[model samples]
Target: MEKYLPYAVLFLRIALALTILAFVADKMGYLTQAGTAPILWGDWDIYTKQLQAILPFIPGNISEKLAIVATLLEIILALMLLFGVKVRWAAIGTGIYALLVAIVAGYGVGINAILHYSLLVISAASFLLACCPIYKFTLHGIKKRSTYHPY
Candidate 1:
């Protein structure tokens, strides 16, 4: 188990990053018309609508703006994790973001939707990554240890 810790962290990192990117893609319309998917919003319009539905207290204008902000944050977080930049901090941020998402989304969609979307799992994985002491396969590690000369 100890020997596999790094691998597990690596797996979580990639999974979280890709999952975030997928949602971002869906919001951007890339995954529009995805076939019978469990939890995709399809495009910005649908995403905004879903956000409004989830938090009906918020005005529609504010909800649309919130959706945009959320998408931007997801993109930044995903890129940071994918590139291994500030991994631990990013993981913490990811954990917090995912947790908030779970709580808010769960409020509207219920336990089943939260479980189906794996938001809690994503949060847990991110927190696990933050607790890990070392990451052996980051871009920084590759750059520092590489013997290749570009000169």
Candidate 2:
């Protein structure tokens, strides 16, 4: 198990990044058409409506802007995780964002529904990655190894 720690962390990082990017893709209508079942939001308008539904505290006017900001942030965080840039901070950010979403969404959809969505699991995985000392499978790892001076 010890020998696989780095691999596990790498898997976690990639999984989180891909999961986030998938949702971003859905919101952007890169995945499915509107009125599609199972997929959350097909386009920005539907995405904004869903956001408003889940987080009703956000004013209708602000929900659209918030959805845009959330989508952009998710893209940035996903890329950061994928490239292993500041992994700890990125993981922490993802964890916090997921946790907040889970909490709010739980209120809207109930615990069982939120659990099915796996937001809490995502948050936990992100926090788990943040706790790692280093990620040995990242681009930074490769670069550092390539630049090593074995004097």
TM-scores, all models, native as reference: 0.87, 0.88
User: Model 2's lDDT to the true fold?
Assistant: 0.85
Error of 1 at 41 (Å): 1.1
- lDDT (C-alpha) at residue 150 in model 2: 16
lDDT of 2 by residue, 54-83 (tens): 888889989888888888999999999998
Model 1 earns a TM-score of 0.87
Predicted candidate 1 versus true structure: per-residue lDDT over 1-151, tens digit per residue: 7778667777888989999999898877786574446547766777788899999999998988888888899999999889887788889999999999999988988888789888999999999888887676677667787321222
For residue 121, what is the lDDT in candidate 2?
A: 93
Lowest lDDT 10-residue stretch of candidate 1: 142-151
What are the Cα lDDT values of the candidates? 0.83, 0.85
Q: Model 2, residue 87: what's the lDDT?
A: 86
